[model samples]
Every structure is written in structure tokens, then in C-alpha cells.
Target: MPEHHSGRARRIPPTLAAGLISLLAVLALLVTLPGTATAGGVKRPVHPDRDWMGVTIRAHEDGAGPSAAAQLTASVEGVDVSSHNGSVSWSSLWNSGVRFAYAKATEGTSYTNPYFTQQYNGSYDRGMIRGAYHFALPDNSSGTSQANYFADHGGGWSRDGRTLPGVLDMEYNPYGDTCYDMSASELVRWIGDFVDQYRYRTGRDAVIYTSTTWWKKCTGNNGGFGSVNPLWIPRYSSSAGELPYGWDFHTIWQYTDSGPTVGDHNRFNGSLSRLQALANG
Candidate 1:
């Protein structure tokens, strides 16, 4: 599933969809400002030992840009193109710098991502490790059903000869009539149930992707899932100095929406080797 507008359920004129798609296509490339190593300086080599937990990230900048070839380290460095539409070139983008990627697999019970197989197979064929994610339903009745749909439809991670972990995208469903209506416990149960079933079928851990606000609001103090699975935390503004609370560790931190890619328009994500370690652990 490529990235799309959140409020897609509301009826939009066909013209609007085409216009939005074109807008996204252009915005994707312009949004990613070059990531500079230091302020007012040329791009420097990414220090493998530097702590990247809460770095202030941007995909592009106005003046000086980070040298494109500089290398940095954390653990696992990758991107999540689930939000990007299916038109992105996964192999070229991943080969640019991304070490691993997670593709959108299924959304609700009936809605499978149109690009799942293409991106999944594309990444695998290029020898870029990849994973799949199911956009979990916030509703109680459909949560389990959506999870099962992913398990059944999402191809085997092992079958592809890749080790990247599958993910359960637990963010708010933008299509809902009411905003932020689901309770914290309810979301946890929904997410937990999905992970349980996914593991049962795939024998692999399901990583959780959510924003700081969603986690704090929906899960509250309940960190039950944090103990068992690696979390992919999405914090848009915080700098590297501010440590995220509640979770013991995160597998990936989506630090910015602006990232450079050969043929992408919106944003990209970053992580460290810890992600791969989490997948193996």
C-alpha cells in the first residue's frame, strides 16, 4: 500500500484524486531536502558511533546539503514507503541508501494494497530486504478480520529469502467519521490480537508502527506490547537529545517526512541496525 491521503473514505471527485496524485508526485521529490551533517557546513561522513536516537531530521534544506555519500550508523537504516503510492521505484530508492523497507500489505479485511506484490517482489528481486505491514482497523469488529487478511494475503517473509520483520500499522484510520474515538485499551487489544495471529501463522514477530500521540492517547500507561515487540516510533519534531518515554527501545524512528529518493515525492524514514537485530531477536 503506497502512501495516500488519510481521508480517502470520504467521496472525492475523480478529478480530485487525479490532482492529488499529481501533487504528491511532485511534492515527493521537493519534500526531501538533503540531510546535512552539521549546520552551515558541507555534508560530512555519517559517524557510525553517533547516537541518532532523537536527531532533528529533514529531507531537504535551503542552502548547504549533506554530502549524499556520507555514511551514518545506528543499527538498521531503512524507509517505510507504505504512505507513498504504489508508483515508487523501490529498488532504485532502496539502493540509494535504504537498507530495509516495509511495504503496505493489506488495509482492512477487504482492502488489500494494490502495490503489495509489486513492491514486495520488486524489493526482493533487487536483493533489497523487505517486510510487509497491515493497516489495522480501529473498529473492534474488523480488527481481527483485517489482521487475518494480512496473514493470508501477505506473502511469506521467509519465502522471499528476506529477514525483514512484518509490521502492524496501528495509526489512527483517517477514514473514520469520528476522530480519535477509539480508547487506548481497545487499540492495544486490537494490535495485540493482530500480532498474535500474525506470529501464529508466520512464526515471526510483528513490529508496531505508531505515532507518539497515538501511543500516549490510545495505549495510555499500558506498555504490554512494548515488552514483546520492537516499536517503530513516529516523532516528527523532536531532536536527538529528547529521549522518547514509555518504550524500552525502538526498532525504527521516522525522524522526517522529507527524504531524498531517486523517484519518490513525499517523505522517507530512517532506522538503524537495531531494527535488524530486533527482527532476529
Candidate 2:
């Protein structure tokens, strides 16, 4: 079973990863579904998982901006290795129009995503822009120890030419019976400690990943670490709309689980010049 820790919950253990792979096998057996018309009149499949979220091509019609499909670069919205294939095989994703990726790094002291190095290095070698994430540790005896463990693992970005930033996964550990023991302020402080130490060593601003529920319960509108770091908000739904709160402008918008990809296993994702700006910063 996958171990659950406060700052260590986001990553999928080897056993869990193996289970997901097997789950996909079962999912493949489901009957194929057809596409439906979206609000924009764009026809999209009801269940995109069946087709690997194939890329959509649109022309510059009705006086819209230049056609994105013609440009050959598409926006990518994706999760870490828990959802997509291992990092090294992401070349198919790049070719299929995936614009960005986030790979799992470390969680607390005991667990590190086994695929982190393979995926991070592999994505870089294939010229795919990618980021790294550290699961937020809860405020307890293991908090700082987990932060040190992440620092030791190098978190994701190297001091090389890579541009994307590291991410701090801040969702609460649902499995812990006492997970709600910490007050909101305490949670903010714990997250801040992780970000501060990570930035000190990596020389890059670590981004924050959280949903509205987790942000409200833990951060309590404190905006942990302030506006100095970027935010990667995850809001999945049919609409691909704006974030709930008037939060800082997100660097990456994880808009959908349904996306285009290069191979049968990879996922599509999106981002703007935000990544370039971070790289130059």
C-alpha cells in the first residue's frame, strides 16, 4: 500500500504506481465513447482517456488569432508521474503536442518517487520542459526532517539550463486520523519552511500546488510564502475556467485530465511564456 505522510502524500509509491498501470489495463477494456460538442462548438470526446487525449487541430476561422494547431505548439495541462507514464518515455508526449510536465520528486524523509530521476532526466534529454514537486509534510516531528530529505534529493530542477520551477504539493494527507490536528496558521508555517529551504538550495522559486479546499483548510488565505513564488492551481472540470479565489496569477493551469499526448500512455499539458520567464528569472 502507498504510505501516507503529511508532506509526503502526493507521490505514488512503487506498488501504487504498479497498480495504476494495471488499472489502465482494465480501463482499456471499456467500450469506446464518442465526442460531444463543447461550449465553443468544438467537438471533444466524452471520455478522452480512451484515445490518449489526441491533439485537436483548429484553423484560423471567424477572425480568431492565428491557428494554434498550425503553429504546431499546444498547451499542456498534466500531473506528476502518478497520472502519466514514467518520465523517460515522454518524447511521444512532446511530439504529440504536450507543452509542459510536472514530475514527482520526494515526500518527507522516507519516500522518494522512484521515477523522479528517470522521468526528470528523460524529459530533459528529450527537450521537453518539465517541473518537479515535493509533497507538503504535515507540521509534526517529521516536518523539518522531511524538508531536509527533499533538499538532499535535489528536489527536481538542477542548476543547469532548465527553466521550469519546482512545485510544493500541499494537499492534506487524507489517511492520517490526526491530520487535521494542526491549525491553519501552523500548516502555512510548515509549508513556508519547506519552500524557504528548497529555494535556498535550488536557487529557483518553488511553485505551490493546491486545490481550493486544501488552500482554505490549511493556508486560510494567508498566501503562504507570499507572492514571491508562483502558483500552479489544479481545478479539473468540463469548463476549463478560472480559479475560485482571486489568487495570484497561476504559472500553470492544470485545466483538465483529458488532454492530447504522444503515445498511448503519456498525457498532454499546457503553460504560457510563464515557464520561460521563470527560467530567465
lDDT (Cα atoms) of all candidates against the true structure: 0.55, 0.53
lDDT of 2 by residue, 180-248 (tens): 467877776677777777777777767776655556655676754545766665544332234425454
List residue ranges in candidate 2 displaced over 4 A.
1-79, 83-88, 139-143, 177-180, 224-226, 238-246, 258-273
> What C-alpha root-mean-square deviation, in Å, does candidate 2 show against the real structure?
17.6
Model 1: residue 104 alpha-carbon error in angstroms: 0.4
Error of 2 at 165 (Å): 2.1
RMSD after CA superposition, every candidate: 17.0, 17.6
State how far residue 80 of model 2 sits from its true place (Å): 2.7
Residues 95-168, model 1: lDDT tens digits = 66666666777655655566667777777676666777766555524455666787888734574345566777
